[model samples]
Target: MTQYQPIAAAAAATEWWRGAVIYQIYPRSFADSNGDGIGDLPGITARLDHVASLGVDAIWLSPFFTSPMKDFGYDIADYCDVDPIFGTLTDFDRLLDRAHALGLKVIIDQVYSHTSDRHAWFQESRSSRGNAKADWYVWADPKPDGSPPSNWQSVFHGPSWTWDGRRGQYYLHNFLPSQPDLNIHNPDVQEAILDTARFWLDRGVDGFRLDAINFSMHDPSLRDNPPVAPGAGPRRRPFDYQHHYYNQSHPDIPTFLARIRRLLDSHGGRFTVAEVGGEQADREMKLFTEGFDRLNSAYGFNFLYADALSPELVRHTIDLWPGAPGEGWPSWAFSNHDAPRHVSRWAAPAERKACAALSMLLLMALRGNVFLYQGEELGLPQADVPFELLQDPEAIANWPNTHGRDGARTPIPWAADAPHAGFSPARPWLPVDPEHVPLAVDRQEEDPDSTLNLTRRLVALRRREEALRCGIIRPLDLAAPLLAFERGDGPDRLLCLFNLGRAPADWRLPEGWTVIEAVGGEATGGSVPPLAGLIARRSA
Candidate 1:
């Protein structure tokens, strides 16, 4: 009975994302046109053909909005316009048209949590207390001792409050001081964001990835957050010491998300996925996307922050989202803009090939919308970006403390021998990883067994199999070193087995199972070789 549920829901018109594949493009690193050091909208437009070739259903672009680049484009100055460095709005139009032409839906990032202080709205809000726009941002009076209103810490490394002489009050910023949080409690602010969405929807964007949406609202009382015990998991910064209760995860966030959903629904078939991170992410993600009135899905940082991949970790993470009723759909990504590449993080130098193939296979087999970051198909490892070339603010600030994002964000290598690895004719804003040159798309395209080709085959495999898409994952109790699960829905059912360890694992296939696809090393109905991943289908 339960197996028939998703199969029924999967047939609905709005369920395109139920098992869709999304390719994420960090615009500035994807490609460069006009010989500029920076990649622009035209560059991404030229690369749509490649993304479409991977058989992904849609594309999720990291922020390319008007910004001062404080936190890259996550700190938006103009929600409705493309940043000059990323090319004009017309360039984006062409990109959207090309993406649709290739049958790929375009999903842009929307940062409603905060706006660049340089934004017209924030500038006016900070001008004077009695001004019309002053209350548009989060403004609170200082304590009698002129101290900050609360003990809330900014994610960047300091007090969340910044004193403003112009307003004679402290404005709250959950991130960088230059990026002030919007007062989402204000109806006008909500309308402004909705209008921004309307502008894009009317212009033809198919969807949006709401950035830090869980932080869209804050507790109005400005209560001090209680500290976590000392020595909380790798506490390198003050921001990691508290529960972050009063600063984010406000109860009212779902209301605003519903408004966003309503607007997206007005445009028809438009999707909205929230980027929900931090403590209480699971609960908040459910609330933000709980029903038909909210977002379609939310992706957290489970695998993104994991140190290693194992049977226990994979099982635990999969169980986190069980597709329970009233629970929103979940999305998963092994690598993305902010995350270090899994090929480097999870595999040893010699085992890199096996790791890439097995990981890609595992990622695609999971039951959710999967995101494949640019170059992930090519198994690009994290670049070793030296300190001199660091561009990411978080990376630079916590240099020795954190893994830093610059390594994973280095420009993609399109051609092994081309200048700047064919990312740009001029020097790129961030250095292209020398190691990535050998794994360039051009070189991998020549070899049928390359990770690039394997990725395409796996993508196609997932697309054609009903059991692989929109099915429920039933974890199988296997011994250590082997991970197995059965994915089933309606008339389609398949068994997936993975040998996670370096040694061969015994696995005589069940009586009725027949091999469908095998990679890394196949299971020959007797033993599964090291790093092997196999899919066996059940005969109807």
Candidate 2:
């Protein structure tokens, strides 16, 4: 049976994404239904209560479309159907129905940048250059010297071009060769991608999370990308050595985004957020969401996948866009499917559990919408994936140099004693970290001071504070290790302070300061001078 719902004009007028907190659940590991050792739609449906209890405005589900699971589900085999591993389209419909019933908006992933080599479109396109779908993907002839068309490099490693023996041509791939980049330059391709979005919109999806959107456009001349000066930063792949100018972030991307925006507009206020990064994240994020005619918002690697969390780093990323420059606002995520859990990444295991909760508080304290990764509220650490069990290509290719995303994608721990920690009765696709068992949902549900409770309280608090909801950020000229700022909306103001170090620091506020909110590593004490954090609202 099909369950249907419609968005009212009144609700649509307000735009659900502004200051909305989205909880991201990676289906492959969220929970397992039927004990299949793999998570599916039914598993996520069973966990809806948990997601709703967090008071999130919506849920952002990572890809679960029909695929070979090459890049998990980013490689789509079918545009409209659900992968058998996750369940059928009916199950997806039911999940959306239930999510809506709980007042949670449903936002799903749309990987428009590429398609699986096995897709029907790719199959027909690769069959012959004169075929109806010939220009659907970015295909080019080998150079006169019999080499690839350009020096662009794939994220997995080596060249971005893959030799197609059947067509005797080279195909462009920004990530995996199995995932060929689509030719957004083609009008036909644009219509086809729009149709994909229309399929979900017709099915009542509230929005889309556009994967690698900036990569949708490529240089038409097939020029070699210039190499970037080498020094060590977060990017380990040699792909980072180049500036990535010709390969991606072309001027034509904004034009394509407008087309996408128009499709989303037909649904009236549907939210679309792009995942953009590399050399031009700041510029591209701004461009991609320059106006209401483009995407609703965009998130970058500014915090997610970062190896550090210094005060200066946090201030710099926020300073890029105060939301005054662009019509589209920004979204922030500290952890997601791609990055290691912030707890394990930012703090030592001994104090990570407490520090993790504090980080969530800090994330909610920021000026933009928040994206909370599934299991993050439980303070789960990264699973230790053995070499033989690795699934991420980048993780496998780089080995010891990188901690493959496999660790973070492990099944969600739902019970302390159940088999595979209640994620599944059978063996899971990825091993549940033994350390995560203690932090299972059931275990933390009863603890009032648990990270789960802290998240619930913080999210609820954020929902109530207008100043923190859509306020402008005012940076206080504070010292390092003591991060201080204010979120103000006219007369209402919130003074936020965080001790980024292990030891406490003091700050003498200007005269007439009154404490409103107190924050700390483990407690929120409002005492003056030595008490770590202070949130003072001006007394009118």
lDDT of 1 by residue, 297-318 (tens): 8986778877788999888777
lDDT of residue 523 for candidate 1: 77
Model 1 misplacement above 4 A: 1-7, 10-14
> Residue 13 in model 2: shift from native, Å?
8.3
Looking at model 1, the pairs that clash are none
lDDT of each: 0.87, 0.84
Quote each prediction's TM-score: 0.97, 0.94
